[model samples]
Target: MIWLVTSICIQIICAVHVIRTGRNQIWMLFIFLFSLLGCFAYLMLEVMPAYWGNRHLRTARAQVAGKVDPERDVRRAQRDLELADTAANHIALGDAQAARGRYAEAEAAYRKGLALGPGNDWGTQVKLAQVLFERGSSREALTLLDGVPEVSRGSEWDRRGLLRARLLADLGRDAEARALFEDVMSRIAGEEARCHYAAFLIERDDRVRARQVLEEVEQRARRLDRTQRVAQADMYRWAGEKLAELRRASA
Candidate 1:
């Protein structure tokens, strides 16, 4: 019974994908009649080829690989750095170390990258600031942020602003932090910005607003595709747990 239900769900999702992507209507029929097998065929024949370079697919693949071998990226990055010691290689090592929560190592890697003159000076500086902040050097992080060239748009801009907001909050500049968080939430569409903003509100005892933000996360989470859901599983889990905690508090 469980297998049948799961197959039906996959068939429905494949049918929806076919319609959305304007694939031949035959795929809908194939998916419906053949169910899971047909869906797998459709994915391999159509979806995978078309979306091989898609960020979501790459992220999902990375997430799965990371789970299976948590230090895989770190190992690869270290090997590359040892072979070339290029700025890009150093930056990559820093990113891998940061992902693994080794902030001290990440900070050293980022500084070495910066010393070697990374291609994106502002971005590398921001990354260094992030690791420094994680290492509890909030004031040094703030200094690094202040030194970077101001970006007015794109994901990099959002990340810089968000980090600055968190730094401000930690430094007891609540008004500045709140304003930046609001600005970031207003400009971004993803659950990360919403979740971070919600967390900020919760920290300040603004449960009503936090609950509303978290409910929005839940709504958007339900609408995400499999790849997107996998990439954002951590944020979604945090939002769910926070919501449950708030509910318990109210009870």
Candidate 2:
């Protein structure tokens, strides 16, 4: 009985760890079926030695690295800057800098790309708005987003609209936020856009609509092109989990 309890505990821990790490669902199922024995087998076969060799493991000979490699970061930043011709490169660099929490650097990179004469560069404008929003300039970000003309409201623009709607909601302009969300949903037809819109609806206590939106997103994600399917998979998975949490809270 004691061994059985220990096995169950290990299985639970392994299941939670797999979920947290976003491992493949098939592997998760296998671990669930075999319990602790399966988890032990997985650890022995699947987990990379390099991952266990990290400095955090006192048993490992590797020493903890001091800090992030600044040289590599600088080189990557420079390479991104060099590639900033069209709007996409600027958007990519802005995303990278934003991920690194260098908001000012991201904004500057986006603005420089915008200034390079790509008329009606909606993506660049949107990225700038995002950076501004992150920097606590929501009003300015809204103003910048509002300037995006209708002609630029293509599939890629849906993300900008969603961001604008979210900011509006944050500022307590619920009516405007709903309007923008509805507008974007009407025009956009992708899993990513639907996932974001669903999140907004769920926040507004509209669970039925949110669930419908998420269902559509799931369907669309399954039909997306290879690259887009991978991207949309992550979005749908997150949206689905958040939707479940919201439902539980309401319950």
What C-alpha lDDT do the candidate models reach, one value each?
0.84, 0.69
Best by TM-score: 1
TM-score of 1: 0.74
* 39-126: candidate 2 lDDT, tens digit per residue: 8755654454645643333222121111212234445667866865655566667766776778998998788778874578776787
Q: What would you estimate as the lDDT of candidate 1?
A: 0.84
Please give the lDDT score at residue 189 for candidate 1: 64
Q: Compose the digit string of candidate 1's lDDT tens values, residues 1-251.
A: 99889888889889999899986677676688777877876786567754577776566545644564578789889999889979889989999999999999998898898899835588888889998888889999999899998876977788888999989988989899989988887777687878888888998999988988888888878888878777777878899999989888888
Error of 2 at 152 (Å): 5.4
Relative to the unseen true structure, what is the C-alpha lDDT of residue 120 in candidate 1, on a scale of 0 to 100? 58
Model 2 is weakest, by summed lDDT over 10 consecutive residues, at 59-68
Give TM-scores for every candidate, taking all chains together and pairing residue i with residue i.
0.74, 0.54
